[model samples]
Target: MTLFETFAAHVDHALDALVAAGTLPAGLDRSNVTVEPPRDAAHGDLSTNAAMVLAKAAGTNPRALAEALSAELAKIDNVTAVEIAGPGFLNLRLHATAWLDELRAIGQSGDDYGRSASGAGKVVNIEYVSANPTGPMHMGHCRGAVVGDALASLLEFSGYKVIREYYINDAGGQVDTLARSAHLRYREALGESIEIPEGLYPGDYLIPVGQRLAEHYGDRYVAAPESEWLVLFRKAAVADMMEMIKADLALLGIHHDLFSSEAELHEAGKAEAAEAELRARGLIYDGELEKPKGKEIEDWEPVTLPLFRSTQFGDDQDRPIKKSNGSWTYFGADLAYHYQKSQNVDAMVDIWGADHAGTVKRIKAAVNALTGGKVQFDIKLVQMVRLLRGGEPIKMSKRSGSFVTLADMIEEVGKDVVRFTMLTRKSDAQMDFDFAKVVEASKDNPVFYVQYAHARIQSTLRKAEGEGLGLDATQLSLLGDAEIALIREAANFPRIVESAGKASEPHRIAFYLSDLAAAFHAYWNLGNDQPDKRFILAHNPALTGARLFLAANIGQVIRNGLRLMGVEAANSM
Candidate 1:
């Protein structure tokens, strides 16, 4: 139904003719022989590397095959010209009218124009922003959160059943520290001069927790032992911080379907359940760990510890499951948590930061050991993001981290810029997020440029009202050269989105929008040189209707592209 599909089918028929003439094999696989927009527009409207890739497989010279194929393609009416370029690439220029029909298709479809069904009914879980509840989310976590959320939206649009989840690290020594910190606040609320010493949290955010404790208990636990209030204070602070974190996520338009708690797992003895499973396979045992190569402690000696045989499944060395103090190491809980995911989800993807790269092998080894290579666990690492303002880097303290929270950034630059810029690069590559650069209303900034296209079309429609255009489907099919070019660019949306969803890379959506924006801007600028090319045809009512249809098509593409990136396509700037 798409213009590309029609072009491709013609190419297939030409290839079939070549086969019938005995110039090519009768049953050659033509799936990889694609008719697509060329990287170099000067080459042609479309190009195919069919000969280059199939030459060796087919035992034929590439240029000779392309020459033979081009001769057959010259018969199609809409194909204006065919040229065999360097290394046997087939370049095609389509008749101007073909593009006009594409405009009609897009305009008639509107918002539904580029909706893809590539994912069908597949289920996928995207787990991201599993930051600890100990503090507020900094700029470091914001990029991945936005990227994951946008990617989920993109996949859903392409027809995937997606579940967005967050893992809550609410169990362990960190909560104890939080409790102690709250106790200090509690005493301070009672008018006690309690110094927030080196070991406890000193942030003013938790002062209210102390106030609430004072208001509820009224000095009941002031003289009581540490045990009574530690549990109560820890629970309250953790719950409040989690709520704050959730609110912060909401500011950026993100929500998780499930919030799996670490404390719940511990309280339910899931770690013990995992340990029992490992013990049955003889993977859990008491062992002595190797001392560090350069940093040995004063009492450095091998100590009996509960260890997991991670080396058997590809880790560098066996890893500790329990520490010398008889407490589980942080990695122990991760093993149980991941092992549980391996059982629950059909397939799993873990989004983590670059610092977690060092731990990937051991984690993978544990999954292999736990599930015996049955379930595949893919770990995607999101690299560091350096937030900049007018090209100046912002330094943030690790303790305070950043005051530029997710909410702060969204309130500043908006959700569309936040999502699109985050996906401008591969997840593993380090990215520079500049506040001054993204807000620029130029082609260099994809968000504004794309939005401008939509606004321009709406403005053109307003101008066309005086030109006697109907703004209906009957008027849309009468498109000219610039109009057709815009429609062909828009038609690429569905295909580009399907490619992005299958690749699990939302950056493709950003890239495609950039290209589409370039096409739209160029077409719109052409009106300055030619009066007829202008969207409003003052002397011709039928032609004006056709141009109005083209303008509507441009708006449709912009809306579809923005929807995929979780951005808005505004009718006006």
Candidate 2:
């Protein structure tokens, strides 16, 4: 158990003693009680709201209950002081030995120190970077890709069975356009000059696909009609495009466990089955949708279609599942896709771009109805990142096929920099990816700053080794107040991991590492002006050993935090 958890149990025991002594009533709900670090370091080491949370249930005033509780808490082994302040909040101060013991625990656990079992029995399916398989991945998809991948790792570290998934949108009109474009390339490959017309893929990336088709079947489909080769060409082009997409994702170290296909889902009648199930439940029916709001459409006409009663689940209006032409709409396919995912996992999370924010309510409603509210679902909308160099915007246009590709970005700044920088902001906030700022070797760059701290620790250990000094057995009580403060900050790793996992926020890990790195750097600067604060004293081997042990464990915690972010802790910057 962590120090906070241990004290929580102690508080519970104290509450039980109060009940036995008839000082307070039994059977109080303590679910809302929380034990955490005080907001102000000067307040105390740890703080809890047990008294404030249980006062009303116990039929007593908060201060009165707190006074009784503090008496019982003062008996805890490592608790040196307990004080009540500001309407019965309990602030605790523990002995320096308690933090020293925690440092020892960090050394013993190493990489496994912050791992938790909170999600032991749960299975999560995270689908991310479901970009259309039309072209290479662009900077638009980078944020969601990094956020989802890091979130998956965080959940797994919290002991979840995670299934990383990707949904291929191949049953749309875009793939047909891709086929026509590939056919043009194929004709060009077979000794015929061709020009790519507007509204077709114009990127040279498809040139190889056309060349391969020409090599395989000389001129059979070159002069044939569109009907004769559309299906065959669409199939071949989607396969090649998927290969390209996977390679681009690999540059960022992302790999999915499953690739679900929309075409296959329709082929297997999954959407039809979903409609039938909803209809049987009286959640789907044939109806005419209300006229869309805003400027009138000259061609608008009321047509009856199969609709899902999403309005009953908090949507603005009922949504159609099938068009008047009897083909499934995009929402219909997505509903079926989520149903398929729900059958296997206890929870599901979708990472999508902020452009799709309007669709979140309807999809969530569909999942709730399909799963009878048994499955947990969340959708994270990531904002777009603006690319810049030295504070000036870098122009890109997807329509002109001149956007910055993910491969190019990774090549320019490296995978680690891209991954870490993508997480330095919240998922739904606008960010500027400045080429000059991200790679700068200064404290303003979080990735470089945190990695430099770990590197500094490694350098010190190497220096100690060369001087015939190494980590040895020593008295941890020799550590001063400054060293204990560092350990106090490092010991919060497990709590940070648990909270981040529960909130489905991987950016918290990045924020915590930046803070811990700052604290370590502050402590390192103290040694320069004070000889007694240095890690190696040459005259005091025991003190040096103790300090080295502390430094090594701080480095371990940094490494563990960086691993969760899918970043490497640099040994040398």
Candidate 3:
């Protein structure tokens, strides 16, 4: 157990003791009780809200309950003192041995130090970067991809069975445009001069698909009517584009466990099945939707369609599952897609772009109605990222086919830089990715600061090994207040992993690592003015060994954190 968890159990025992003495009522609700570090270090080592949470149920004020709880908590072996502050908060100080034991635990656990079982094997399916198959992966999809991928790793570390999924939007009209574009390129490859029309994809990335088609089919479909070859060309072009998309994602070290196709979902009648079930339950019906909100339409008309009762679940209006022409709408297909995902998982998470924020409520409502609220569902909307260079905006236009591709970004700044920089901000906040600032190699750059700390630790361990000063016979008691403070910071990794996983925010890991790195750097700088504080002392091998052991474990924590972000910790900078 972590230091926080260990003390939580102690608090539980203390509460039970209060019940045994009839000082507090039995079976009071304690779920709101929390044990965490005090906000200020001057307060104490650990803080708990047990007294304030249960005082009302026990027929006592918060202060009296805190006073009674403090006496029992004082009996813990490592608890040095318990202080009551504010209304009823209990802050407990621990002996240095508590942190020393945790430092040793870090050494013992290594890469597995921060892992937890908080998720308890619950299966969670995360769908992210489900971009349309009409173009290459761009900066538009980068943030959500990295966020979802890191979240998957974090949840897995917290013991959740996670499924990484990508939804291919191949059943839309955009794919037909891609098909026509590919046909144009196919004719170009067959020695015919062609111009890309305004509505078709114009990027040179599709040039190879046309050449391959020309080689395989050799003029068979070059002059055929649109009906004779639209499906065939759409299939081929989507297959090629998907290959390109996967390759681009690989550059950022992202790979999905499943690639679900929208076309396949329709072909298998999943949408029809979902509609039938919801209609049978009175959650869907044939109705006419109101006119578009906040807009004046010269030729607006109401038409009857099968609509899902999304308004009952907090949507602004009832959503249409199918249009009057009998084809499924995007919401209709997406609703079925989520239903298919819910069949095999206990929960589902969707990482979507902020542009799709308007549809979140309806989709959530559909999922709730389909599952009868039995399944846990969450949708995270990631805001846009503006690429910049030296504080100036770098403009891009996807329609003009001049936008920056994921491959180009990865090739320029490297995958580690791209992945780490993408997560430095909250997913919902707009961020500027300045190419110059991200690779600045200064403390202002979190990626560099964290990696530099790891590299420094590895270099120190190497020097210690060269000097034949091993960590085998070290005494942790030699670690004084300064070293113990560093240990205190390092020991929060497990708590961080659990909290970040529970909150579904992987950026918290990046923020925590930055804090830990700053602590280690401050501790490292202490050796410059004080000769005895340095890690390497030729006169005293014992002290050097203890410090080296501490440094080694801090490096281990850094490695574990960087692994979740999919960034490599540099051994030397």
List model 3 lDDT by residue over 1-573, tens digit each. 878888899999999999999998888999889998899988989999999989888889999999999999999999999999999999999999999989988888889998988889999999999989988899988999999999999999999999999999999999999999999999999999999989888899889999999999999998899999899999999999999999999999999999999999999999999999899899899999998989799898999999999888778788898987899998999888988889988899999999999999889978888888888999998999999999999998877789989999999899999999988999999999998999999999999999999999999989889989877425878889999999989988898888889889999999999999999999999999998889888898888888989999999999999999999999999
> What is candidate 3's local distance difference test score?
0.92
- What stretches of model 3 exceed 4 Å from their correct place? 293-298
lDDT per residue for candidate 2 within 81-137, as digits (tens), equals 999989999999999988988888888888999988899869999999999888899
Clashes of each: 0, 0, 0
Least well predicted 10-residue stretch by lDDT in candidate 2: 467-476
Query: Which stretches in model 1 have alpha-carbon errors above 4 Å?
Result: 5-35, 54-84, 273-287, 304-315, 368-376, 398-402, 466-478
In candidate 2 the C-alpha lDDT for residue 229 amounts to: 96
Work out the TM-score per prediction: 0.87, 0.98, 0.98
Q: Residue-wise lDDT of candidate 1 within 1-573, one digit each (tens)? A: 677778888878887787788878777777678878888867778888877876777789999999998888889888899999998999999887677667777766777776667677566678899987876676789777877887788778877778888998888887888888888888889999987777667777778888988998889888889988888888888888888889888877788998999888888787888888888889889899988778758888789987888788677778998889976788888888887767755556678998998788887777677888776667778998998999999777534433567777888998778877888888899899899999997777877887887888887787677554657556555665566666767778877877777677778887887788788778778878877777676687777777677677777787787787777877788
Candidate 3 local Cα displacement, residue 267, angstroms: 0.7
Better of 1 and 2 by lDDT: 2
Measured with C-alpha atoms, the lDDT of residue 373 in candidate 1 is 79
